[model samples]
Target: MYCPFCSHIEDKVIDSRLSKEGDVIRRRRECFNCKQRFTTYERVGEIFPMVIKKDGRRERFNREKIFNGMKRACEKRPVSIDVLETVVGDIEKKIQEIGESEIPSHIIGKELMNQLQKLDHVAYVRFASVYKEFKDISEFMSEIKSLAPQSVVSYEQNPSKTIDGVPL
Candidate 1:
């Protein structure tokens, strides 16, 4: 590696250590010319796929957006940031494994919904309301009922209340 101190092309690694997760390498190097010591970290660069929007627009994949969306969904809920981070990481890794240069935005949305549904029902509904853009009360109720089928049973028990005569 090139030495930053004297711009020398030669350097000796004094020590090397792996990061906690083993995804990074920390190296202590000494410049052969200037004898200066420096630390460097090496990591595998990730090439993320492009996000093809609903309107045909494309943009680089951003993990922060995923984290923010999950955070918003899980707000005031029992879910933790670490869980959200893992979900985001899993989605990112899955996309990367596909080896495609572009991925549909709807697919990403579906993945988020799938993970959130398993994580928390209330949070899933909160996210679905925004993601699916519920236009009417019936749509929201339908989603909530589908999310929790027990609600369907309870609503069935009350035959007086009818959702378009289907009894919810």
Candidate 2:
């Protein structure tokens, strides 16, 4: 291993641990030259399917993109980072289990939306807005309505009330 502090190639592993899922290994390393410590993660480089975009372009599957999108959707919400990480991990596992050389982007998007919907309604709508590309307020309302029929009915009855800080 290379030392991050001094770019030295020699390092000693101080500790090593497996992730909860047992799919990743974390190692703590100390540089021999600078005596600096850093952590590194190791995981099997499994082959993933290429994502087929809306425009018919194929690109390598990116885990970071999914995590970032979910992060943005859950921003300022009560959701925790651990929950988001688990969600991303679940999606990645599902994709791998599909065992396809190429998969439609919509499948991934729908799965993410489904996961977020169970996590937080506000986050689900936030993600759906972008993923589904709502053209107007009605389209957005339709999604919210589908999430909670009682809440939508109450909002219709009382327009002054707000759902997730948004006025009806």
For this target, which candidate reaches the highest TM-score against the unseen true structure? 2
Please give each candidate's TM-score. Answer: 0.62, 0.63
Over all chains combined, what TM-score does candidate 2 have? 0.63
Best by lDDT: 2
Off by over 4 Å in 2: 1-46, 149-168
What residue runs in model 1 are displaced by over 4 Å at the alpha carbon? 1-46, 149-168
lDDT of 2 by residue, 1-168 (tens): 788889999876655555666456576878989999999997633446788999999886776689899999999999998788778877876787777788888888877976887799999999999998899999999888887867646645785653323232
Write down the lDDT of every candidate, Cα atoms only: 0.76, 0.78
lDDT of 1 by residue, 35-149 (tens): 9999988662344667899999988676667878999999999998767766776776566776667777887887788688779999999999999999999999999878677
Alpha-carbon deviation at 93 in model 2, angstroms: 0.3
